[model samples]
Target: MAAPSPRPAGSYGMDASWVPWLWAAIGIVYLVLAGFSVFSWGAPLWVTFLVAVLGLAFLAGGALFWNASAHGKFLVWRELLDELPAPARVLDLGCGRGAVTIMTAEAFPRADVTGVDLWRSIDQSGNSPAAAEANATVNGVSGRTRFVTGDMTALPQFDGGSFDLVTASLAIHNIHSPLGRRSAIGEAWRVLSPGGRLVIVDISKVDEYIVHLRALGAALTVRRAGWRMWWSGPWMATRILIAAKPGASS
Candidate 1:
């Protein structure tokens, strides 16, 4: 097998690259229709104007999404991780291609990071355990990083309170079912050591996660994930959640 390319600093594969591609494709179609209406069909002025505006808007949105996926998202995660104390053990849920996993390793130099994911391509293009492993290699965290093909809702390989820090980024929403997502959050909470921290960034079902964690007796605080985490626009923006498990660390 060929060797993995060394991913450069600040260089990471796209997260849901298809989302932006779909946006750009739709924008192109709209622009084409607008051109056809203006030149060949002599369609209504308002119709042409509307389509043209939509085309430009969609294209702009697509560019933003692409930028955010490639660069902005990592910057945001790095910034978020920087504010916390160094963790000795970290668990990254749904660590597609190791963006957050590698970030955690870099953020906490002494930490041993483990990533778990189902590696579905629909969730992230080129998603695979090997891809995640290669990313860790290229990012110079291979020695301290590992990837496992597993579902977040049920992490059988790990014991409860196994990690000092748990993180999920743009991953939990993929569960599709509310109960399943809640279970995943419960699992994250389960694997956290006492006084350990759980940080999640997701675009959907934020309220459900917060409520579930609150019910579990976690001290929860949440806020907007900011524009860098916006998948397409503000309407689809992600949020960051920080939950602290009770009791002191052993």
Candidate 2:
């Protein structure tokens, strides 16, 4: 695909709160301490060696953070885009700053996309409807895209059989109540016409979500997001689930 227009300023984003650079920060501090120890007069050989080793470990940890929390999130969008087809109705649940939302619009320009989010800064920096709109505008898909503020659990606001594709990215697990989370998934199911599909990327209780969706009588697949898709790598937790509502090409 051709390169997109300049990404909207302060619209595309990173959330420091989601995965803080504490490991990277600590690595820098350790390297500094190791250098200081080496240069200090009469520094013990073993102490310097130990500090160097510690620094290396933290550095590796930082790489994991960048891979899992940063790069891995984008893979979610790539996979979803692969699954979606053109000229379809799409919804993004908890589309913080339109990261996945705008990408979807850009990937399938013919498709109509809508992003809904609470836009709570505490949820993710740049998580706002205005940011999402600006992102879509600069990305050259604003004409076919829109953002709205709404709760995932109470998304009955959308009419039944209104959408062909629905996505939730790293957002649904925030629903603390089991009932609320199930309801939110149900809402996703409700908006889908036959043959519609739902894709979700989440951090916890993925199996629970699978069980919930299965109970709702849909065909679905659930699996670990794996190293490339897990920003935190295999340990920190991430999962992908895809479900189809059985019917047309949605």
lDDT of 1 by residue, 1-250 (tens): 9953222353346777788989999999999999999999999999999999999989988988987787677777877988888889999999888888988898788999999989888878888888878778877899999998898999989999999999998889989899899999999999999999999988878999999999999998899978876777898888889999998952
TM-score of 2: 0.82
Off by over 4 Å in 2: 1-10, 16-18, 29-54, 67-70
Clashes of each: 0, 4
> C-alpha displacement of 134 in model 2, angstroms?
0.8
lDDT of 2 by residue, 42-68 (tens): 579898888888877777766766665
Model 2: number of backbone collisions: 4
Candidate 1 clashes between residue pairs 3 or more apart in a chain or in different chains = none
Q: The CA-based lDDT of model 2 is what?
A: 0.77
- The local distance difference test score of each candidate is 0.87, 0.77
Q: Look at candidate 2 and tell me the lDDT of residue 95.
A: 86
